[model samples]
Target chain A: MPAVHAEGLFKVFGRRPADAVRRLQDGASVADVRESGATPAVIDAGFSVEPGEIFVVMGLSGSGKSTLLRMLNGLLETTAGTVRVGDAELTALDAPALRRLRQERMSMVFQHFALFPHRSVLDNAAYALEVRGVDRATRRAKAREALALVGLDQWADQKPGQLSGGMKQRVGLARALAADTDLLLMDEAFSALDPLIRREMQDQLLELQASLGKTIVFITHDLNEAMRLGDRIAIMRDGRIVQIGTPDQILETPADDYVRQFLADVDRGRVFTAGHVMVPAPALVAPTAAPAQVLQTMRDTRAGSVLVGDGDGRVVGVATEDVVRTAVAAGASSLAGLPLLPAVDVRATTPLNDLLAAAAQDEVPVTVVDDDGRLAGVVPRGAVLAALGGVPRPAAQPPVALAEAEAVPPADETALITSGGIRG
Target chain B: MAESSDDSGLLPRIPVGEWVDTAFDWVTENFEPVLDAISTASGAGVDGLTDALLLPPAILLAALLALLGGVLRSVRFGIASLVGLLLLISMEMWEPAMQTLALILVATVIAVAIGIPVGIAAAKSSRVSAVVRPVLDFMQTMPALVYLIPAVTFFGIGVVSGVVMTIIFALPPGVRLTELGIRQVDGELVEAGHAFGSPPGKILRGVQLPLALPTIMAGVNQVIMLALSMAVIAGFVGAGGLGGLVVTSLSRLDLGLGVEAGLAVVILAIYLDRLTSAFGQQRRGFPSFLSRGGTVTTTAAASSRSVDAPVTGATDQNARPEPAR
Candidate 1:
């Protein structure tokens, strides 16, 4: 079951909130709700977050993303809807029960790093546990461990005022982690940091998330951050979720003009990973296959080369037509005895921007590997160029030929590939 | 008679003063027992404190205060306290100074105990804040001497009445600032406290109170200053202290006695003001001898833990490889 689920959530603020929600339920516009002396902050919002997924909610200010998040934790009551975290119905829970659930099962990291200025860093980080009435010695030990995860154990004794903004934010993150809750709600957790610090914090969070496997609902206004961290992102506008999809899915087909406009400024090269563009490996030959058989597979597939894999499907190397012919002339019994060309391999998640240099140097298509270095797919030079082009190619269009794509002048190629457009 | 015959005034005179007098009389007649109980308890408490402060040798007490100044603030502040106290001693104002100190301390403690909770209530509820705002304004803006009338009626003429007047006069700022300080705390911090599943009381004590401490201390400083000023006015009703000397010197036009008493008040004010304000600043000034030892141990412990971090981080990463999701 999904760890957090919200169905048809409606949050209205000001006079006669229930009336406003009814008007909205009856298909009144947001403007109509506002005209009736109530502001509909979140209208008919619904989504579910799977356990261990980083579900990002991306929107500008006033989009009601923060309000939506507060409802999920029972911090703000919904005018109408249901929120379930695990087996507990958050909306149905009494105040004390909700607070208990918050204390024991969920925690939040705030944008401003809401650390107590008077308390030492360790005390601030341990505050959640403290409120839960955990004994002093044990809470402090847990807080110390959490701080160490953020590389800030040394600063635990210092006041929050003494730490820089990044370190203060780290303390806030540590505080949430110390609770050891299965779900984390981050409200622009890194938005207040400098650009360089923001990137570093993102990397640290991802690194920690890898082992923790905690379900995270991360909210941010930055599209690039959403794309980089989220497994699936929900794009919100005017208090409504317009679309929810993976990064490439959203890039390939935006739901509306607003979504398309939001995507206009996104760096596609950095957003699209090798896995998004890679095709199935054109031809495969087992390492123990004879040279004659390897050449036959390459010829049958109408490819320049074939990937040699061991029985376990781990990519061994590439055997080109030239190498296979030489090996056949030498009367090699098996291609494993022949010297194979070293294959340029990258993880499936390697961004297309990082693969450009590799794509340029290797004649054969770059190999995509999953965990255990097993062959997953191949990213040809043409595929990378096509994915980075100005207009997304139609799915039915065949993959562009490398020769035809390279025919464009180098300057035009750079313009087409980069977010910048082709020069007049 | 001719001016009265014209009879073209704005309106008849309002009997506000008469109404107030009648109200005081009614309260005095109806709550005599309760008022007497309060008077006796407070009078005993103030007297006990005064006797305790006077029990120590003047020189020993002066040294102790000076040492406290050094430890809580800086070495320079300590010497200043010592010099100021010695001057007061040489001027033969030590007894009265200690008495005034007793009064100020008791009044301040009572005011803070009442003020902070009310302030917190006002901060939490808009309705409470609305009701409190105007009442605080009236208390603060009224002439300080006016409180003495009701105080005198309730407690009779003595130090108890003086303490009561001082409390009424000094109480407004404490309440106002406490409310302001808690209200001024960052909204996000309060939300974080709530988000972490803390009950309201825990949030108030652990988050709101600690964050508002500096501001509340400022309020306490205001209270003490106001109490000292009002205590002098209380001298008119026969309360003893440096204020009594000033009143006596004023009646007799004795310049020497007046200067000595006024200067003693100044010295006390300067000492208390510096100490309380320093406490508010929290480790910004010269390091205190009392706190330095604590700092050294914490620093050592922190550094050792910091050193242990990278080693564990390295091993932890090696142990838990990134899972491909």
Candidate 2:
């Protein structure tokens, strides 16, 4: 049996009694929601969740992604159509049976981290177990174990408010873990965090999923988030599943215009890697090569930048045509003194947001490096944007609005780094 | 010796002697004056109290809140609420009713002003909440009568003491709910706020407050009802108006008068509750402004304890969210 199955679900809400009923009764596709009293929120939507797959329901607000997620646990009953969790038909189950199913078989981590504020982190995490009538000591021990799994072992006595955004989410995950459920539902769990924090959480989730192997249904509207986290994503539109497929398959092929448009604005720069960038590392570099030689080498190699190595086979300098003229004209004394952006190689472990921030704003392409400072390859700014869902490279040097997003410039950075300031 | 100290620490030891001593001191300081104020107000006619003299203001307030409620929900609900107020007046219950309304309004205002900030504090600081939690629990469970003694002692009867006790009784919902609202606020919005480099205060004021307004307003609504409930109790001390009237009628066993006054109180309660709820529902600043649907199933899921029960229990489908049917 499928883990979660919704067969032709229908939920309508509106005013104007007769008309609203007519829409639902007549099966008018795409009922004019604005009209009459009853607005059908979800209509004839159907889907099935297979075991052990990280199934993602992706949709913007009002598409009923959250409603769909809630229906799985019987937090909400479908207006029309049958819902089944595992082999048990949810529509047929009584409230107590549903609660038992939710408590024993599945756990939900709300988007808001709905950990009880009155309880300590341990108690909050262990609440599901406590509700299940587990002994306090055993429940607490389980909570501690779960908290450790989420890397929040030390914050046991603290409340949800005391923890950071990512930490609170960890507690939410810990609560689900303590429930000892086979299935976990995450409703935009990390969407409420800072971008950097969000990235870390995604990586953490991926790592956790790999370890726990819990059958998870993750809901998110952010296409990039969906692409990164989902084993298979179900793109939802107007309370219906448009398509379901893996990231690579979805990226190369979208189901419809809605999916395509969403994919268009995605930031792919961080997702792409040096494997896509490397041509072949050059064995030699001429010390006295003219600008023409460097230009020829770059073109022949199809490299965004060329590394200038010494006799010891260590990279001493690098040259990119975009800014090489300044370096060349400045002479070795001044040039070598100023470290070039292309020469500094970043590791694979580097997050995209950080990599973008560290990379120079100019036409410099960032180089990728392995553990030993050996050049792996390079990732251009364009590639980061591509990997991130091909979001338009904003006109601003920084991908974000610096004044608003990077506003207040962390007291330390504000003191030292002074560059091209956005003139108001 | 250490074991004895530890053993002593584990005892449920409240001093009846000390309680009696304080209680005696409190009664002498308050009981007489509260009695005096009541006799004085009754002799001076009900108009001498806050309501009759403040009739225009009371009606004006009702009108304004009712109008706002109308815009939020429907004109009919607003009009019906106004009529509810009119019934209180037609029963010749105007002065006492108004006094009761005034005390409730004042108490609720103070409760909101103080409660919301403390609630926000609780939401932000678990340590602070841990400290405040037991205090709030005590405030909640200590009984309205128990709180009245302190309220009378501190504020010394009449409107002041009445308002004080009302605040004590009603303050919890405001704070607890503010904390709840803040807690329940969508994480996405908070993150979006943070992503904008918004400080904690800004995120709270701009994002969390607006989104949580529905729940916070629900708290405010609870606070209002609690304040009203405290009104009759407030009468036992020095609070003037309908509560005083009830005490008078109940004392004489004036069946006609007692039932009439009681009915007036219910009318006032209905008017206020409806008006406040409608206003809460109609909040335009609320992100969705979708009056909580009249759905049986709220965000709350039923526990495994019951299944045959209609998922949406018939305790009138959570009045907080129910749209006008």
State TM-scores per candidate. 0.84, 0.44
The 10-residue segment of model 1 chain A with minimum total lDDT is A415-424
In the range A279-300, model 1's lDDT, one tens digit per residue, is 5543356677788876675555
lDDT of 2: 0.66
Question: What is candidate 2's lDDT per residue for A32-143, written digit by digit as tens?
Answer: 5445446666666777878877898899998989888777776666667888878888789975676677667888777877665545899878777765778989999999
Candidate 2 B-chain TM-score: 0.72
Each candidate's DockQ: 0.63, 0.02
Q: What shift in Å separates residue A78 of candidate 2 from its native position after superposition?
A: 0.3
In model 2, the runs with Cα more than 4 Å from the true position are A15-27, A268-424, B1-325
